[model samples]
Target chain A: MKILVCLGNVPDTTTKIRFDGEMKNLATEGVQWVINPWDELALTRALEIKEGSGGKIEKVSVVNVGKADAEPTIRKALAIGADDAYRIDADPSDAYFIAAQIAEVVKNNNFEIIFAGKESSDFNGSAVGSMLAEFLDIPSVSAVSAFDFPDGKVVLKRDIDGGKETIGIDTPFVTIVQKGISINPRIPAMRGIMMARTKPINVSQPVAVDTLVEYETFELPEAKAECKMVDPENTDALVDLLHNEAKVI
Target chain B: MDFELTEEQLMMKQAARDFAERELLPDVIERDAEARFPVRQVKMLAELGFFGISVDPQYGGSGMDALSYVLALEEIAKIDSATAVILAVHNSLVAYGIETYGNEDQKQKFLPELASGNKIGAFLLSEPEAGSDATSQKTTAEDKGDYYLLNGTKNWITSADNAGIYLVIAQTDPDKKHKGINAFIVDRHSEGISLGPHEEKMGMRSSDTHSVMFTDVKVPKENRIGEDGFGFKFAMKLLDGGRIGIAAQAIGIAGGAFDRAVQYSKERKAFGTEIANHQAVAFKLADMAVKLENGRNLVYKCATLKDQKKDFSTLSAMAKQYCADSAMEITTEAVQIHGGYGYVKEYHVERLMREAKVTQIYEGTSEIQKIVISRSLLKD
Candidate 1:
């Protein structure tokens, strides 16, 4: 059995975001790219499963819907213990577009289980995993935290309304994993990093997919104003200010 | 020519950053306060193959280039200088020395354990009498045909309490003086070995530092590195590489402090705006930044020279000298920028500043480095 994790190439969390001249796209001048955090966790869980499978699980591959600039991020997945990698050479347009693109390649492969992070860290669009499932006409379980494969039987602990609900699922399904899937994402060892150099990232031309959403213009969030600390004896002034400035009193 | 890190090097840098931020940063203050060794973190580093970052894979090492080691060491030092020094002594001094000079039996016996982190390694050269003047050796390793009976007291040894293997330098024949020096790989658990209590240090307190005492310790002939009288030259060569690690560590310490200061300045309000808006603080930041960059470039050049199998001894001395001095300066200014907050332990700049002091004094003093560079210059 093979597992496929959907990888996303996103900027490092510490990057100071800046927009391009058009105000519709991020400036890529000094961005350090990395694998999306949640996606990395998903990959880690998959690798752990493969390591413990004892020949039951053959390979854990990764597929990324990104452009050439995302190669390093994709290779990071390979270094993190993904058996093989594929990059659909296209700018990740949107959640639906990315889902549709990934489905096309996955349909041709022998991937029994597919995993995707609930959302990419760059754009918190909690839609890709389900969209991919719909695109492939397969069932998917969302909000999964724990996954176990015992004696060829798949089990999952999914987050419910107030607690976790244990679930038993079969193969040929998509799993949208959230936190608690793994404690920490695996850091690539020196051996893995060395081997990653020759591990090929099989790049293929992306099939035509329609974008559902387009940004008109990008704007920075408003800078928060300093809070005015009110003295204990100034309740009346505070009330007056609240009534006039906040207009919520 | 170019300043681009390879894929492996970038991964190493990122892994080091993650490990430092996740494992070392949280309890670093508490560790510093308690003067505790980072036992758990050291194990994690060993598991990550950092202990053998530059050793050959055949000997169970990571077979990485010098740049990768520096990138990782810099990150580690940025978070915990104590832990970084432990790694420095192991990789650059002990493991590197053994791999470069050891025979097949020594490599097969010692390298695997050292690389695996199962057995920690320490370099014992500095005695109570000899500090900067390494030629003066009072310890004796009396030749006894099959083995040498060692008797010495090595002071200021990092990881002395935790190390399982010792790279001991001692005088084999007093008649030959410095030329009679020999290096041996002595098992630290030997019957005659003892250690002094851990030192109460001003900075880098988390690493276990103790003076090692050896009384009639037996080391077989196979454990000696190279031919007789090769010990001094071996120690000198290994010190060159060790300087590279320390230089990176110094830069990292400075960088760590500088980072905290920059963040604090931007948030710290003075008259009506952030302290960063003040020209005095801003100029200090500029100077610190330039020094850090210059030091980093010099260190990287040395690492690159080493990777290319070129002679890096003189430049490494310069790197160690410049980086250690600037680290002391930058850390002091970082604390100054943090004002009252920096004086405390939780703010971390205080700890970084304190930790930066030893970089100038250890491995080779700044004055010793100047002597090396001057000699190379005169010769050139």
Candidate 2:
């Protein structure tokens, strides 16, 4: 089965972010890039299926929609046991545009399954995979808790707001895996990293279509208010503060 | 340049960690307090294919890399150093010795049983007179045609009484000096072979230590490893690998102590805040983590190098010295972090502290390691 996993390269959470007031871009001084946590789970699951089935994986390709900056994350995705990778060279600005780019490449691939994270941490939109599925006109199970291919059928359990629903789809399907699915995706060992260096990475220039959604100047949230402490000795004042000011009573 | 571990190595790490947390940790303190030999834990280790981790699959053992063996040892030792030694001695010192230096017939004769964990093995090197100066050993093996009559007393032998086989190094020709020593494989059932009373140790009491005696014990000529006079060199070579195992063991102990310290510091309250809020306690933890991570990286590098047949003597010595020292510091700090509770036997950190002290002394002392480093530098 041909499995395509969408991996994103983003600054790790511990990365220090600096914004230049002069230019409208975040400074990339000492940034470390890692595979998106959700994408990691999806890749690991795909690798598991590839190993367990004893069937030849046509390609464990990582499909990314970003510029050359995203290649390292693609490389790391390869390092984490993906067979190969595909990077669509276009800075992903909007969810729909990115989805359209993915659908363009995947339309002719005849891929059995396309796996992706439920949401990218940087955007937190949780819309890309669903949009990609819509663009490709394939059944997609988003926010999947578990995925299993038992008896030649793809089985997926997706968590909704209230409960989980188990859905079995045919061979060709799309799954947007959520975080905390499998054991935290393993850091590719030194050997896997070295081996990844020699593996094939297909890079293509896919210009994203113009979109309505555009980024304006980014702004920070308002500062928090100062905390007020109640005097324990003054019962009347504490009661008055609780009822009128703090509103706890 | 290939620095990655195989899938088997990854599995070994998980297995050792799982075994340590589930089987070893629960009774580790009680075992240490009572100076108990964790026979059950030893059996469990054997069941997990730990006793012969580096042995070939053809020999009924897990055909794992040297790094995998060390990684597993580090995890096990983190929970219980005593149980870890049982694994180290059996695999590194004894089984590894035979596998590397023994003839094809010898390998077929003994390795399968030892590798299968069906029979335990121990290496006898340190005599009462010999500790670090192993050449000073007084044990003798006189050739008697078909068999050699062995007479020696090996002190501080781990798994001495229970081991089915003992790989003994003895003076075959006293006049030839260090060259006179020869390696012999002696079965425990051999006549006049007896185990002295188990010694009461400060820590790692859960691993059995005793003096093994050889009085007119006859081992066949076929049992001798390699040629005569090659024993000391073989022993030292075996020890190079053994040092890596001890390094891993040290990392495990340090990792365990540090984990407990971190957990306690986060929970224990003092002066209206958790002890972790205090920079003194917090810095201690941070230092411990730093030392552990660095030491672990070195040990793993050394182990991986050894597996790849790369030049690893310097790395092994560095790892052994750094990890052993780190373990001592970390476990000591772990006790201090526990404050009053750490002084008592009820807390495991106290036991860990005692266990950490020996790692620096054995498998070549930290001082000896410095000497090795200096010697290598001089040669270079």
Candidate 3:
């Protein structure tokens, strides 16, 4: 079985985010890019599934819909044990466009399974996996927190409103994985990094798709107010502040 | 002239950092307090190919450069010096010594297991009387044609109980003194070999340190690292490389302490504002950062020199001395920044301070390093 993982790059969670002068784009200066955390979990789970398959799963490939600048992030996935990578040379304008690019590869490759993060941390669009499934005309499972492969079928567990729900699907499926699928994402060892340098990363031209969304402006979240310390001795005062000034009891 | 780490090196550093934070940091304080060896974590590191960071790929190693090894070591040491020292000894001292000096047969026999960490390795050079002056002869290896009868006691040996193989330095000829010393690869499970109870330490408590005794244990002739008289030179050469590892460890410890102090300064309030806003606390952070940068530069320079196979003894000694001193001073200041909380174990700085002290004392003491540096300069 051949598996494909869709990788996305985002600023590290701890990076100090800033907006450009026009407030329409992220300030990239000094920003450290990482494999989107959710996508990393997805890639990790795919590798884990391959390992557990006992020779049934033959290959794991990662694809990214971005420019050459994103190759490092793609290489990171390769270092984490992906067999190879596909770079779709295009600006990742929107989920639909990105999904279309992936679908083009899937049509040619005939991959049995495709995995993607439930949402990219940058845009939080939560749209690509399902859209890719729709474009490819295959089953798509979202918010997959756990999975297993038994007798070549996909058994996935996902979180519902109050609990989890399990579903079994046939081959040729798309899964948008989240946390809890894998205990932790594997860090690429030094050996892996060395090998990744020589690993095949096939770059291909993007299959053009009409984008339906456009960014208007970017805004930073409002800064939080300084904390107000409450005196333990004045219970009434604390209660009054909570009820009136803070307006919470 | 390029100072930036290569992409591969950065990835290796990130991998080590991630592993250290996730696997080693969780129970580190508790482990230190309980003096428990992090066996599971060590195995994890081995699985990640850390045991053979600089070993050749054919020898089951990652085949990385020395700078990469230093980067990884620094990241690991930043979180837990105990675990870092274990890795350092295995990679820098034991496996490196064997790969550099051992014959092809010895390399084939030991490098694979050592690199894979199936058999952990330790360097046994220091003794009760042979700490600073490593040439003092007490351990003896009686040449017996087919094998040698080894008898000695090694003190303050790292990973003593856990190591499966030991690179033991012993005297083959009592009359030759330092020239008489021979390096031997002795299996820890050899007959007549015994271990003393673990030593309770001030810092790096989780790292197992013990006394190893060899009472007439027979070591195969093939296990001798080099020629009979080559032991002293072998030990010295390996120690020069070992200094780079220790220096990296020192930088890591100092970096860790500085990071914590910076975080604390930001969160701590004094005079109705964050302590970081105050000049006194801010200047301390500045000083710590400058020292850390200098120490890191020295460490990497030594590592690069070693990787290039140049004569780096003086540089290694200088790097080790400066970095270790920086670690001690920085950690002490970190505790001071934390105030009373730093004095206690809950805050973690006190433990870092304790762990930093040994770096100044072990491998080669700061005083010994100075001697090496001065001697080199004078000779020039």
Candidate with the greatest TM-score versus the true structure: 3
Tens digits of per-residue lDDT for model 3, B102-168: 9999999999999998989998998888888998959999999999999889999999999999999
Candidate 3 stretches with Cα past 4 Å from truth are: A233-240, A243-249
TM-score of 3: 0.98
Q: Candidate 1 overall Cα lDDT vs. reference?
A: 0.92
True contacts recovered per prediction: 0.58, 0.00, 0.77
Q: Per-residue lDDT for A33-101 in model 2, tens only?
A: 667878888898888877776575555777888888777678777666788877787877778888888
List, residue by residue over B1-380, the lDDT tens digit for candidate 2: 76666644654575577678878888988888787878787776676567777788777676678888888888888889998888898999889999888999999889988986778888899988998888886999998989899997998888887789899999999999999999889898888988899889888888888998889998899999888888888888888888898999999989988988888888898998899999999999989999998998999898778877888888788999999999999999999999998888776888888899889987689998898888999994
Instruction: For each candidate in turn, give its C-alpha RMSD to the true structure in angstroms.
Output: 1.6, 6.9, 1.2
Give the interface RMSD of each candidate: 1.0, 9.5, 0.8
lDDT of 3 at B298: 97
Candidate 2 vs candidate 3: the TM-score winner is 3
Candidate 1 Cα misplacement greater than 4 A, ranges: A210-214, A236-249
lDDT of 1 by residue, B1-380 (tens): 89998877888899999999999999999999999999898898888898888889999998999999999999989989899999999999999999988998999999999998988999999999998888898889999999999998999999998999999999999899789999999998999999999999999999989999999999998889999999989999999999999999999999999999999999999998899999999999999999999999999999999999999999999999999999999999999999999998889999999999999999999999999999999994
* Model 3 error, position A119 (Å): 0.5
Report the TM-score of candidate 1, chain A only.
0.92
Candidate 3 local lDDT, A25-46, one digit each (tens): 8898998889989889888888
